[model samples]
Target: MNLNAIKYCLRQGVVSLFRNFWLAVVTAGMIAVSLAILGGFLLVALNVGQILYNIAGNVEISVFLRDDADQELIRTRLDGLDGVREHTFIPREQGLTDFGYALGDSALFAGLAGENNPLPDMFRVRVGESDMVEALAEKMRAFPGVEFVDYGEELVARLLGVTRWLNAFFLAISFLLAASAVFLIVTIIRLSVMARQEEIGVMKYLGASNFFIRAPFFLEGMAMGWAGALSAAVALGAAYHRLAFSLQREALLFFLQPVTDPEKLWPVFAGLLALGTVMGGLGSLVSVRRFVRA
Candidate 1:
């Protein structure tokens, strides 16, 4: 289409929105509500995933040694092992002292000092990769003089499993929300087309191409979608910012830190806008194809 034709279509689209101002508002409101819910869930899922990731990254393997185990030999082997980021050897006495400090009751273990200490010498091993933790722990367990290895294996496995399930849930929720938004947009466009049936019919009879007949409806759908998404983004961003500020001030939920940076948020808002615009255009295309014939 020529520039003038495009301008005419755009003008008609804007005029149609103004003519049906209340309906347009309702359409935008519905779209905004749907998007807001989707965005809110997405933010929550992202933050949870990040917290899990941090916890997994800090996982450490504790290798306890038998009393007769050759500590120097085990240390040498550990140094040669792959995926072993670093290892700290804790003597039995030091281990007991550390435990006492952790418990904040040194008097309870006061009699257990020196020869009376029952704690075994242990090596605290940090793995370079979380995925290799189990393998590394197994290798350490096989080492001569090693009593056992404990790395909170169950906890790490559960964390990973929870993260996977969360991702699947997010995908399902996203699909449902997107489908609902598209359906809402389609219904709105169909109603708009029905309201202007005679006008579309006259345009079709006056040698106007199918594109010319459909362009205004397409623009209208996109406009509504864009406006709704913009509103949702602004409202959601403000709410999240306020929430982050409150949490920081109260020193609550230190583990699950909310994303408060505008630089990070702008991209998400842009993505939401793009998604809304595309859905709007697609909904318009579907409605016009069926209602505005050549």
Candidate 2:
């Protein structure tokens, strides 16, 4: 508790670590591996979330206007909607042109379609909020001049559901890894304490209190936590950048831009480091308490 006691605890922790260097490294490695797995899960989940969000952003309600509908009235209706941020009117000719573009050849469709453009003129409405897109599309379905309402609401909802499940799965895995890491740390500290049981017994016989006997091991735990966490941060940061590039090669991979920037990985690294150290310190303290009390 005092300065001398604190210094003694730190010195004892250092000496004990050197004496058990191989065991300590093994323990640290286990912590690093577990933290790295958790880190990978977090990185993937975050990227998936960003990808889903981008997909949702592209979801717009297409309100198709009937040939008999008044253009001015439709414009007025769109302008009056609070959720509507902007709308682009796609005329029948424009729709035909877009359709042709998607068909591959530029001039093949131009010769065939002249008097009647079968494509419908529609308003591509961008809602202010993504969540409002569904409701706004539904409302527009019953409005005058709207022949059909189009938005991938069902797909977006399903993607969101998948994302939620992935997040939950990651959380469960993280919890299990975290518990395993703590148990390993506690076991390591306990074994170290038991190895020096004679020294602790001698100290207690010489009037050392429970706190005196426990303080050194707790400090040792804090040291192990800091080391293990730092290692994990470095390992995870390196792994994330590598995996991002590897996954980007797949054409279907979304959020490509984010996975490319390794510098943008500071948040995850810092979080993992802090988490590892805290878990280590707490686990060490827990193991030390029982021995000290005994």
Candidate 3:
């Protein structure tokens, strides 16, 4: 723990990496590959979740108004609602025009459009939360001048359920991958130690404490981990940008925008780097403990 001792440990760690260059590279490669797999899954899941939630946020309640109802009174009632994010009043004429647009040939409906517009005036309400849509719709239905409310209650419920299940599934997968990565590091460190068992035994005979003997190996493992993490981050960043850029030109892949901007990627970079170091340190600790006991 003194200055000289710390220097010695640091030198030993650096020396060991070069002394076993192939092993060091192999260990680092394993960490990179494992973390890359985990990171790729996380990136995809996060983007998908964002897109789904964006769609969910757009879910709105449609409140149809009676033709004879007081429009101002209905507007006032809607404005007073607690969870409403925004509301757009759609006039009967606008509704007919939208319907004609959907039909793709506005000229096809030109004859009967004005006098025969059968659509009712509507208030389209976007709520702050998807779960609040049903409750808001119920309140809207009871308000005077509101003819009916339709919020696609069943679809909202199903979408929420799917999101919850998807989150749970991703969490489970993350834990499993993390544990596997740790175990892999442990195996790698153990092999490195086994190769240098005689040196460790000689150090023990020379009055070296367990901490003195273990610190260098632990540092070496951490170095490998850090190196591996940097590699994975660079690779993932390039791959993510390439995929995101390619998807931009394809309309069908509109919802598949992978987040590749540097600002958004900083956290992911930090997380993978930290994860690699911890796994490496843990693997070293496990190997040292087992070897010392033996």
Candidate 4:
């Protein structure tokens, strides 16, 4: 709490790092590995969700033509509409062909190719006035030349809804993992302090105050946490970068990129440092608690 106590703890923390170097390294390494995985995956999951959400951002409408409708008249009417931005026509034959391809090239739809295509001729339309989309779709469906209007009105909305919940779930999981790792590291530091009980007892007998006795071990613990985080970050980064370089130059990023960007390393390093510092302080506190009271 006082300057001398603080100074003493810091000095002890430095000494403890060297005194218990191996233990510190092991503890730090473990924490780093755990945190790295937790942070990396969570970051990736969130970013991927953002990408999916972005790609489906713009809305589109589909208009299916009536079997008896005049094709040219429908096209002319759709083109004359105020809200339609762009339109693509898919003949019934084209729809059947596409459906066949989608079913893994199944020959079940080959019958459609023989005589008549049963699939509806459809128009894929993008609207400039998003607010007017519903109205325009309704109008097209009501029109004599159109059979039905669909804007993927349900499917896209459902996808966005699912992703929203999934993102929250993943974030909560990541937080839990990180917290568990930190708690474990703190406990390890406490054990290390207890292992050196005799020295602490002797120091107390020699008139060392609580603060004087606690600093080094605390600092050491904190240092260990930092070291572990840093090691894990570097290891995870290297693995992710190598994988990214060797394999998916594009696709894998949609879900989770891990450590592709070097720019993100800074935040990872900062997190490690913070974790270490917290661990160190807690370890020192545990070490000095009993001695000070004694």
Each model's lDDT: 0.87, 0.80, 0.83, 0.69
- lDDT tens digits by residue: candidate 2, 1-294: 689988887898888887888888988888988888888887877777677667777778889888887778888888988889888888888777887888987675786465666767798888765667778888888788788888887876786678778889989998999899999999999999899999998998899888778877777777777788788878777766677667777677544645454464677778888888788778888988866665
Clashing residue pair totals per candidate (backbone < 3 A): 0, 0, 0, 10
- Top lDDT: which candidate number? 1
Could you tell me the TM-score of candidate 2? 0.73
Q: Which ten residues in a row have the lowest lDDT in candidate 3?
A: 106-115
lDDT of 4 by residue, 1-294 (tens): 788777776776677677767776777767876777776675566456545544454677878887888888878888988878888898888878878889888577887774577778888888764446677888788767788888866756566667777778877877776666766666666776777788888988899866566667656766776677667767766776676666456675545443455465566556655755665556446544643465
Q: State which candidate, 1 or 2, has the greater TM-score.
A: 1
lDDT of 3 by residue, 14-132 (tens): 98889889978987887898888878877877786777767778998989999888888889998999999999999988777777889997666666666687789998889887767
Which residue window of length 10 is worst by lDDT in model 1?
A: 256-265
Backbone clash pairs in model 1 (N, Cα, C under 3 Å; residues 3+ apart or in different chains), count: 0
The candidate scoring highest on TM-score is 1
Q: Which digits, one per residue and each the tens of the lDDT, describe model 1 over residues 273-292?
A: 89888888998899889887
TM-score of every prediction relative to native: 0.77, 0.73, 0.76, 0.56
Query: In candidate 2, residue 152 scores what lDDT?
Result: 82
Sorting all predicted structures by TM-score, with the top scorer first, yields 1, 3, 2, 4
Predicted candidate 3: what Cα RMSD to the true structure?
Answer: 4.1
The better-scoring model by lDDT among 2 and 4 is 2
User: Which regions of candidate 3 deviate over 4 angstroms?
Assistant: 63-84, 90-122, 128-149, 205-209
